[model samples]
Target: MASRWVLVAVSAAQLAAGAAGQVIALSEGRAFDIDVLGFRGSPARLGRDSWLLGTGLSAPVLMLSVQAVATIRLAAGSSRGATRVLGSLGALMTCGYLIEKEARGALSPAGWNPTTTPAVAAGLTLAVTMAVLGPRQASSSS
Candidate 1:
């Protein structure tokens, strides 16, 4: 029970970290390509906001929303194979994103990125939590 709450909190913190990064990037006028579906769909450029929404229409919003729902499902202990798969994918995606950001010079390559370090830590925690949960149990219905 307590473990579930910890997972949820960590997941939320990771999500929050992501949101904060977007806000900062937008405020700093950092022009970057946001993946529409994370290597699936076309990348959309985010910069030069006209209405000031910035990233409100970006895919991260959708991604974070899905993650939020997944965290709730995991907390309910109803998550199984798909949950693990998505969790791993999300963590890997975060890694890839950080690397990309570094390459793009949005993040300092000399050392850790102050803006994204929390995301990395929270993401690592979530990944470990999912690993500790292991694979899905064999269904009793079988």
Candidate 2:
């Protein structure tokens, strides 16, 4: 349905943005610039290329999840609880990335990196809006 496609497109965009952020972090030589919670050491120094991969990996997951929600919404005429959870999680991730980027100063946290705060904010806003908007059953013909 058109709605599902829209969700998929939105998710894809988010994923792409995240991937770009990660690339930026790596290129800037500050990959993992933000400490993971209490842990220290940068991912770049740790030789964690997988971390970068992880950023890329998140895109599919979000896309798939959005597609699933789209299907469920189309079938049931409402967004599932899972979508809400994902939205909240996304918001948290966005905030964490923002915080890390802010802490890094000049370097930004990838995979939700806030160096591009506006993008992050937009993503967060979209996620929240989608969650709140729930889903409308796709018209049989439309």
Candidate 3:
């Protein structure tokens, strides 16, 4: 929130999260609803089990709107609220990535994912920490 770099980092994380959701949904296949992806189709035909699927930073319009508006607010340097929202969104995105990977493999086999990258991991952590705990307080010279 203090530096432009943090804003860029958070924004980048948001974009990554959006992409990650799409990839996860595609990989999920069955419960992946076209409706959730902005098209029209009932997930019932695919035997939808978990609402968690087709959700996250790619959940229809909610995430998109939230991310868009929040990013704008942040870029304007207008609100800490924006950072909080950004942080929360980042956490959700990171969680989706992690959950999908873990369900596929319990720290075991099955190749890699965007979430596996160290930069992605660090970015998400920083964003989440910013949201939940706010930017680190500067040490007082007093």
> RMSD of each candidate?
6.5, 7.2, 7.6
Q: What tens-digit string does per-residue lDDT give for candidate 1 at 1-142?
A: 4545555566666666556656655564443433443432222455443123223212245566666677777667745543554455455545445444321343345645665544444544454554443232213212
**Highest TM-score: which candidate?**
1
Predict model 2's lDDT versus the native.
0.43
Question: Across residues 27-60, which tens digit of lDDT does each residue of candidate 2 receive?
Answer: 5554333444643345455336424222211222
Q: Estimate every model's Cα lDDT from 0 to 1.
A: 0.47, 0.43, 0.47
- Model 1: lDDT equals 0.47
Which residue runs of candidate 2 sit more than 4 Å off their true CA positions?
A: 1-3, 33-39, 46-85, 102-142
Q: Which stretches of candidate 1 lie over 4 Å from their true place?
A: 33-44, 47-59, 102-142
Error of 1 at 44 (Å): 9.4
Worst-scoring 10-residue span by lDDT in model 2: 52-61
Query: Model 2 compared with the native: what TM-score?
Result: 0.46
The per-residue C-alpha lDDT of model 2 at residue 12 equals: 47
C-alpha RMSD between model 3 and the true structure = 7.6
Of the pair 1 and 2, which is ahead by lDDT?
1
